[model samples]
Target chain A: MRTLVLVFHPDLEGASRANKALVRAARELPDDTVTVRDVYALYPDGVIDVAAEQRLVEAHDRIVMEFPLYWYSAPALLKEWEDKVLAFGWAYGPGGEALAGKEIAVVTTAGGPESEYVEEDGGATMREVLSPYRMMARYTHAVWKEPFVVFESMELSDEALVTTGRKYQAFLTD
Target chain B: MRTLVLVFHPDLEGASRANKALVRAARELPDDTVTVRDVYALYPDGVIDVAAEQRLVEAHDRIVMEFPLYWYSAPALLKEWEDKVLAFGWAYGPGGEALAGKEIAVVTTAGGPESEYVEEDGGATMREVLSPYRMMARYTHAVWKEPFVVFESMELSDEALVTTGRKYQAFLTD
Candidate 1:
């Protein structure tokens, strides 16, 4: 299946390491099968071209949303994409069938460790944190897959990022 | 206690009746006690002023985030505000005591009915969908209150909106 990876990071080259590495790995996939779009680069002004986005999604069988977790969710621009691109008639509601039957996945890197996400640690589990996306996928009739998360991103060494990137590549292709 | 209600509707004056009513009710409060900010109007370009936002939060003992729910979450600009204004060392990590002991509450209106938000209906409950905000409040050392939700917004009559708005005013003050 053709997979489209929409990477949404404000400073992918400057402030990010793990996400960049992951994107690089995703890019290394055979060109015919995977298409990677750096959403922030594409829309620096924060205005999304709804038609273009819908067309891109229609072209792909699997949609992977890659980003760094901000406030336990995707960046604002990504949210903007959802608000603007995923319209009522196009993505859901009465006549919305554009995204139906497509597969949706999330790949996120978090600065905090996995243990910090539990209730005992006073933080929410990844599942609870990502519930909105899950529900959105359901509402859009897209098949939601389990998320791929890179935890404790701040502590990962260069070698560790490469290892995780390799794993991410396998996950995307699998 | 001084209350700051950051209203993040894309268009409060237009395309919104319930939210406008809510804001009007909020305005009826004593001017010295409550500050209502139209966030989207303040930043038409989607750029948030971090320093000003921090100062606004600092000035208030209670913070109420009022918005029309988009895809089961706050609007994109609100997410942008969270990503930018709630920075490291200011909202979390070390020395992030600016919001400590402050009360944080969410007041939202949903186009869908309350029944659509239940697990049996293949959607997330309000608590689960709003978990990220609750966790963010906890992470920032702020007090998290039960969210105030207005359901079936599209069907609410003008009279119903006024009643709901009055209740919203009470909720913010209480």
Candidate 2:
């Protein structure tokens, strides 16, 4: 299946460790089954080309939104892309069948440890935090896949990063 | 209490009914008690003025983020504003104390009904869907009140809208 990886990092080339590694591994695949688009590079001014984004979605069988979880969500540019690209009559409401049968997934990295996300641990669970994306999948009638998350990303070792990267590549293919 | 209402609707005057009503009600309050800001109008090109937004937040004792739920989350501009304005070392991280002890609330309208937002019902719970904002509140050391949501917004009656507006004003104060 053709997978579209929509990457949303404000500084992918600078300051990103885990996500950068993941991207590199995803790109190393030779089959051309995956395509990566860095959103910040595409729209530095934050203006999204809605039709073009829709066309990309139409061309892909599975859609992956990859990002570093900033302030418990994706970066501002991805949010802008979603609001503009996913229009009323095209992505939802009447006659909105653009993403009816596609598969959707989220790949995100978080600064905090996984244990901190539990209710009693003074943090939200990953499932809770990612509910918006899950709901979006449901709304669009897209197949929702289990998310690929990297917790405690700030402290991940280089060896672990490469391991995670390989796992992420396998996830895209699976 | 001084309250700042940051309105994040793409077309507040044209496409939004519930949001417009809420804005009108919030604005009708005494100027000394409340301030209404149309964020989209302020930044038509989706470019956020970080300094200006930070100043607005600092000026208010209570901050209410008002938006129509898009993709089961806040509209893109609101997320952009949050990501940009709530920067590290300012909103969180080391020496980030700008929002400490403040109160933050989300006043949102959803197209879907309340009954639809449950795990068993194939919908995400309201609390789960909005956990990102809740987590932001936690990270910023702000008090997070229960979010004020108007589900089935499209079906709301004129009387309900007015009532919701009045309750919203009360929510701002209390």
Candidate 3:
């Protein structure tokens, strides 16, 4: 299946380490199987091109939204993209079938440890924190898959990064 | 108590009726008791003034985030504001006490009906859908109040809008 990885790091080249590693891994996937689009690079001005984004969504069989967790959610630009690209007539209202039957998943990196996300651990569970995306998938009638998350992202060693990268690539293929 | 109402409608004067009514009600509150800020109007280019926004948070006892739910979330600019204005050492990490002990409430209007938000109704529960914001309040150590939501916003009658407006004003006071 054709997989589209939509990366949403504001400064992927400069500051991000974990997300950049994942992006590299995603890029290594066979060209015919995977397509990676860095949204910030595409919309530096933050204005999303709705028609183009919709076309990309239609072309992909599986859509993976990749980003670093910010303020317990995806970056603002990603949210903007969702709000603009997934319009009423095209994504959800009557006659909206742009994203139906497509598989949707989230691939994200978090600064905190995984244990910190549990309610008993004084943090929200990953499922709770990412409910917006889940809801969006439901609204669009897209099949939701288990999200791929890498925790303690800021502290991942080089060895760990490489391992995670391979695993991310495997996720796209598997 | 000083209340800060940050409005997040892209076109506050043109597109939304419920939002306009809510903002009008907030404005009717005593000026000393409430401060109204239309975020889009202030930052037309989506370039947020972080220092000014932080000051607004610091000065308020209760923060009200009012918006029309787009794609089950606020507009992109609000997320941008959260990413930029609520910075480390100022909102959450060490020495981040600007929002600690403050009350945070959400006032939102959704195009979907309340019945559609239940798990059995082919939609997520309102609580589940808003868990991200709830987690944000938890991270910031802010007191979260039950959100004020107007479901089936597109079907709101003139009288219902007035009632919702009055209730919204009371909610701010309470």
> Where does the lowest 10-residue lDDT sum fall in candidate 2 chain A?
A115-124
lDDT of 2 by residue, A6-102 (tens): 9999899898998899889888876469988888988888878888999999999999999999888998777788888888889888999898899
**Can you write out model 3's per-residue Cα lDDT over B1-174, one digit (the tens) per residue?**
899999999999998899999999999999999999999999999999999999889989999999999878898888999899999999978999898899999889999888878877446678777777777888888998899999998899999999999999999999
Best by TM-score: 1
Write model 1 residue lDDT over B1-174, tens digit each, in one string.
999999999999999877898899999998889999999999999888899999999999999999999998998998999999999899888998888899999999999889888877567788889988998899888999899999998899888988898898889789
Ranking by lDDT: 1, 3, 2
Model 1 spans with C-alpha error above 4 angstroms: none
CA displacement after TM-score superposition, residue B7 of candidate 2 (Å): 1.0
Q: What is the TM-score of chain B in candidate 2?
A: 0.97
For B1-174, candidate 2 gives per-residue lDDT tens digits of 898999999999999999999999998999999999999999998878899889889999988899999888888888788889999999988999999989989999998888888888567789999999988999899988899999999999999999999998888878
Best by DockQ: 1
TM-score, cand. 3 vs. native: 0.97
Clashes of each: 0, 1, 0
Model 3 alpha-carbon miss at residue B139, Å: 1.2
Candidate 1 at A60: error in angstroms? 0.3
Q: Could you report the DockQ of all the candidates, in the order they appear? A: 0.82, 0.80, 0.70
| Interface RMSD, Å, model 2 | 1.3
Give a tens-digit lDDT track for model 1, residues A1-174: 999999999999898899999999999999889999999999999989999999999999999999999888999998899999999888988899988999999999998889888866556789889999999999899999899999999889999999998999888888
TM-score of each: 0.97, 0.95, 0.97
